[model samples]
Target: MSVAIPIFKPVSQMQLTPGSTVTIPDVTWEEFESILQELGEKRASRIAYNQGNLEIMVPLPEHEISKDLISDIVKILLKAKGIKYQPFGSTTFKKQGTAGVEADACFYIQNYQQMIGKRRLQPDDPPPDLAIETDVTSKTTLGAYEAIGVPELWIFDSGKLAIYLLKDGKYIKSEQSPYFEDIAITQIIPDTVERSWQVGSFQALEEFANLYLSIIE
Candidate 1:
């Protein structure tokens, strides 16, 4: 007897316009791993897998801009608060026989010490304290993050930022982030990010930093 193998179209043949997405259903975990291997780490696409469904998305320019702005804002706030953090940009996180997701940006805050000098995430290691997603191309599904047990998830869409906190093995919407509860992050971040589109990222970030300094001082 001979084993039959499934054939997949080459990634290069897929015409994914910016802000577009493709979903493949009933993908096995092994096949998902094979697809990841095929895609490689240098690609510009982001992927999410839940159960047997796989999603591939190409972000638009607006999405990239928003992701960068929000990540920068997070770094500024962490620095101003004297908090140590390790940023992981678009790193693929996976759990065996379960789910996988690539965050637009992620950070190890309370667990920063654990991640120091670490190159790849181990199964026993803690997931990121915060994960960010920009929904310019497609809406983010909570299944993967929920399965991965990420503590905090932020989704920027339609000029607004929505925060989700994992509690009791599930996610719940919250107005304040547990890490930055003292500040109105949901409001300030979105406003500043939108302001960046008008005045350029450098000036907007500088202003945000100065404002934050004034508040803490």
Candidate 2:
């Protein structure tokens, strides 16, 4: 699954026609590689002290679910369908242009590996087909994925989910999957946002998936 990244990229690529509005910094691929290496080393150190739990850095939020009930409920339902899932993992690409980005939760019908210039994420590497993000950080991080070419992006912020699918070199709102074809937010996200008036509306999403699944099957 390929997607657009929000970074400044060279207009030299024929397909990526230069836009008078956008200007990419002319940094060699070597510079990006070195930056990744340094960041990985420092982040890896902090990750070492923490085990079992996922933490990229001490101050940064851990790979956490704001709603554990919703997380567990959704995973259980998806697993029943035999779906493969991974959370917050990096996927790098090949050749001179590449990037390594981690997502909050990603779904894959199948998995792939990461191949960097001097490094690789081996057979055990998991590159997800669909990635979800909790947009607490600057929206700029979203562009990083666009630049690196992630196919699907689901951003949840302030209790709303904004989804995008890469189409024709840009990310646009999409309700359906181009890769899975049948998969959509409703299939991946629990419909808890619709039922149980006992809980506030914002909190209802936790019940949507579980309730919908029970009704369907």
Candidate 3:
């Protein structure tokens, strides 16, 4: 006699509220990929898969605002330094059967030349130089990023920014970003983001740009 196995519902059939997260256990890599296809590219939810656990999170408005503000700050600094960068916002990055994650924001700076005109990540391609996450909805799954070997990760949570650098196959908390080693990014980023919430994004950026220029000069 054959027993019936339960089939997982399609991701489209699910309803996830903002600032909520859902975890599905024992999901195979094949199933994970299938779910990604179902979710499509235009969705607001973010996903992370590790080993056999899949986590999906719906970000809040505050989360989106903070991430956009932070990413803008990064771009401003990059432009001021005359650094070339490619921003891939919330792109899904996978490491075959091991792990996969969609970062809140990611950038290719050191390897920007290699990523030119690339649609999908090739197996030999290096991961993004920087990945950003806002933990307003749920905590980011660092294991997925570690498995994929992302060199740097920044997490904004509780009105503060935390930088993690990948070293020797593990993530180590760092005081500053290697890309912006000369600048006090930890303090500047948090302050700028907070000011944006209070005054406005445009005014905050203008003020921060002036301050950054003074510091660099």
Candidate 4:
């Protein structure tokens, strides 16, 4: 009788965890869907899938704080301006035979009426008019979202806001928002965020409401 021993080698695949992003290249669409299925709900919240590439991110405290603040401010501004909107926070946008992305926060401004009272979304549902992403640990790319055809993207990075407009199947850095065409976000949002850090969201939101109201008035 003879005994045989097998040698093991270290695997190189990335292991994702909180407060970081893991990117896996050359992934198949089926494999991506299986990963999403395995993640179920909670874990899948932080996943983004591109063409043959998967990126998983864990939001830090700062990331969450900034995301919520940014979302709250946007809502406040919308209300102040008397604009109709529907908040679709982090709703997973998955396209058939294409990429999928979970934005930090999303909103239906121009298309709000279209998604009224909807519970579940289909693959063919119109994408959100605006999606806000907080970039603290990892940069959010426009490629995956381009496939989804999200019209406007707001990236809050390093205490600054950058707006991108989707035009002709690509993203272009823009000075004004497509939805809020007249408002100058770069002038207001940064200062409002800084104030929020100094004196809670409540006070900051109040101040932002007044600022927006003044502009529209």
Q: Per-residue alpha-carbon lDDT of model 2 for 97-148, expressed as tens digits?
A: 4333455455554542232232544434434556665533433345555655
Per-candidate TM vs. native? 0.93, 0.52, 0.93, 0.87
Give candidate 1 misplaced runs (Cα > 4 Å): 1-8, 136-140
lDDT of 3 by residue, 24-106 (tens): 88989999999999989999899999888899999999999999999999998888788999998888998999899999999
- Indicate whether candidate 1 or candidate 2 has the larger lDDT: 1
Candidate 4 residues 79-187, lDDT tens each? 8778899999988898776788889999998889989998989766899999999883333346788888999989888888889898898889999986567888876
TM-score of model 3 (CA atoms): 0.93
Off by over 4 Å in 2: 1-28, 41-63, 67-74, 85-95, 112-127, 136-140, 176-210
- Residue 96's lDDT within candidate 1 is 81
Residue 187, model 3: Cα distance from true site in angstroms? 0.9
lDDT of 1: 0.88
> What is the lDDT of every predicted structure here?
0.88, 0.45, 0.89, 0.79
Steric clashes per prediction: 0, 17, 0, 0
Cα displacement (angstroms), candidate 4, residue 41, comes to 1.6
Candidate order (TM-score): 3, 1, 4, 2
lDDT of 1 by residue, 156-189 (tens): 9898899999999788999998878789999998
Q: Name the TM-score of candidate 2.
A: 0.52
